[model samples]
Target: MTQTAQLYRMVMEDHVCPYGLKSKDLLERQGFAVDDNHLSSREETDAFKKEHGVDTTPQTFIDGQRIGGHDALKKHFGQDVREEGETTYRPIIAIFSVAALMALALAVGSLGTVLHIRVLEWFIAISMCFLAVQKLQDVESFSTMFLNYDLLARKWVPYGKIYPFGEALAGILMVGGILPFLSVPVALFIGTIGAISVFKAVYIDKRELKCACVGGESNVPLGFVSLTENLMMIVMGLWMGTKAFLL
Candidate 1:
């Protein structure tokens, strides 16, 4: 009988060897025999090294062959490892710069204030449409990560499902401004969601975590301005929600 043996040496410390847990689960699920030796003390690690000629925690031995650390495990699991880039504020700064330019356009336009507001509204609607379309086009990726599909299925669904409808509704509302009664409510709802999403994006960036936002290429830190923007959106959403409910 040919016996396949898998051994794992791991330290029982918090947040260390995160991949070890994953590997253990995967190996068990795949019907591989696994032997786990937990080293809770330095003495244990030393004794393990004397026995196996390896002194590293989170090390794996397959058929008495050392497979190194986390990187090797990831490679064995068929994961594509890539070099992460140095995080910078370039992308976020660019986005804010564009927003500032739009604001400036609104400020400097020779047109009347009402016309400027209309232009701003249209611009916001178009921008939302663009983001919604991008998200929808890459629904699988975004949905799997940022959005909670199970919760959405049960209740509190994300706006992505009905993004096009919302965009169309916003466009129609901006067109005639006839339903001034409904405007605030719609805006408030969308604004609230947008704020939350932006906040989450900021949180991810601050923690140096990867996100699907910005196409996973850039890690943009969340700034105070982004928080303020979200708060403003929340206020707008509340105003709109109230109007929609009342009138």
Candidate 2:
């Protein structure tokens, strides 16, 4: 059995009982079998609460660790449960960055095949580079907007500090189209960091999060598609980095 499954078995004693009925339902939904008879007694529950620092019903115990009540459970399940107003622009930035690169590639290929002159290649390359830089700037601006404390829609999240500054730096490099050898590492690092930030923000803060990307207001869930985009950018960045610097 899974840890959550075992935890459910250990915590619920009477499925029909008032004390753990809600918790039992939640556990069942999470693929745990509920057997209330095996649950701790009322006196035992009080002691368990005291011993584990739990003062609420529907409290979860994951391998003896008190993961908290309903809010905690939702969080564990990757549901939206955060305080209001925690904004994240990582997705928007990521999408734009990839799109800019693709545009740059297309511009280069067209110029090389049609014009045949190296000058056209340089011109298209420069333009694409400029566009990439603009996209990077947009990402920064969006991230700043989300981080703004003055915005009422901005949430107070203490967890964003854990991400490294390297992520933003790497994004800047990708936009600048610099150092081909380092593109993969840069994109991967930035995307991974951004992905974690986005997921955590969405999962903890249960609400339709505003997209920081261009046209992000279209009402779309920032799900696996966004994550895949970042990963693809990393690959593209890596390829570009290699071709630009090495070949």
Once superposed on the true structure, which residue ranges of model 1 sit more than 4 Å away at CA? 1-88, 110-137, 148-160, 163-183, 193-218, 221-229, 238-247
TM-score of each predicted structure versus truth: 0.39, 0.32
Summarize candidate 2's per-residue lDDT along 75-185 as a digit string, tens digits. 777887646545545444565566545555655665544333333323323333333343345444444433422122235343123122334445445545565455456
Error of 1 at 40 (Å): 60
Cα-based lDDT for every prediction: 0.52, 0.48
Cα lDDT over the full model 1? 0.52
Error of 2 at 174 (Å): 5.4
**Candidate 1: worst-modelled 10 consecutive residues by lDDT:** 145-154
Task: Provide backbone clash counts, one per model.
Answer: 5, 11
What's the CA RMSD of model 2 in angstroms?
16.4
Q: List the residue pairs that clash in candidate 1.
A: 184-240, 185-240, 185-241, 188-236, 188-237
Worst-scoring 10-residue span by lDDT in model 2:
157-166
